[model samples]
Target: MAHYKAADSKREQFRRYLEKSGVLDTLTKALLLTSKDVVLVALYEEPEKPNSALDFLKHHLGASAPENPEIEALRLEVAEMKEKYEAVLEENKKLKTKLAQYEPPQEEKRDE
Candidate 1:
């Protein structure tokens, strides 16, 4: 999910709102089309939960999948950081060695 841009991530929320609004209007139209004393009842009335079996499976299965794009992006970022860190450490070691070669030797003080 992190790999998705802010706009793409909000697509789901936008779609939900769109579907909800459409359903509300559609239901009113459908009710008008119905005959007298014919009550249209939904077994599951809540929009928060999945209305169909396919939606239910998709929700549960997608949660545990290993080949997620967001996880892969994080792994790549970590590897890039590790390479940069290692290169800096090597450069620091080389700089310290060069610095030591340019330094004057310490002179021992004689006892007065």
Candidate 2:
């Protein structure tokens, strides 16, 4: 069934994520790989409702969840940097507008 295949695919994806997260040691990684194959077999036998592999991984891994901490830190840093950059840009724009306003306009040339 399509559902069975999707579940199997999700299990494989979770295994890959476990490997990629870099939080697992060799023993744990190997165990997870083995468990993934077992899960695939179980799902093929009896498929369950579709669930987000990312969410499942995040829940299981807790503090070791991929990208949460790092992303939060980067987001904060980016927000601060963007705020500073925008302030400078706004100031520059205001100065340019003031300069243009103060510049004297040329008079129209008289016809010969």
lDDT of 1: 0.54
Give one digit per residue, the lDDT tens place, for model 2 in 3-61: 99998898776567545644234335445666555544443344442354433433443
The TM-score leader among the candidates is 2
What lDDT tens digits, residue by residue, belong to model 1 across residues 7-67? 5765566446436645434444443434211212221323464444334333433433567
Q: Rate the local accuracy (lDDT) of all candidates.
A: 0.54, 0.60
Candidate 2's displacement at residue 48, Å, is: 6.3
Model 1: lDDT of residue 100? 79
User: Which parts of model 2 are misplaced by more than 4 Å?
Assistant: 1-54, 57-71, 106-112
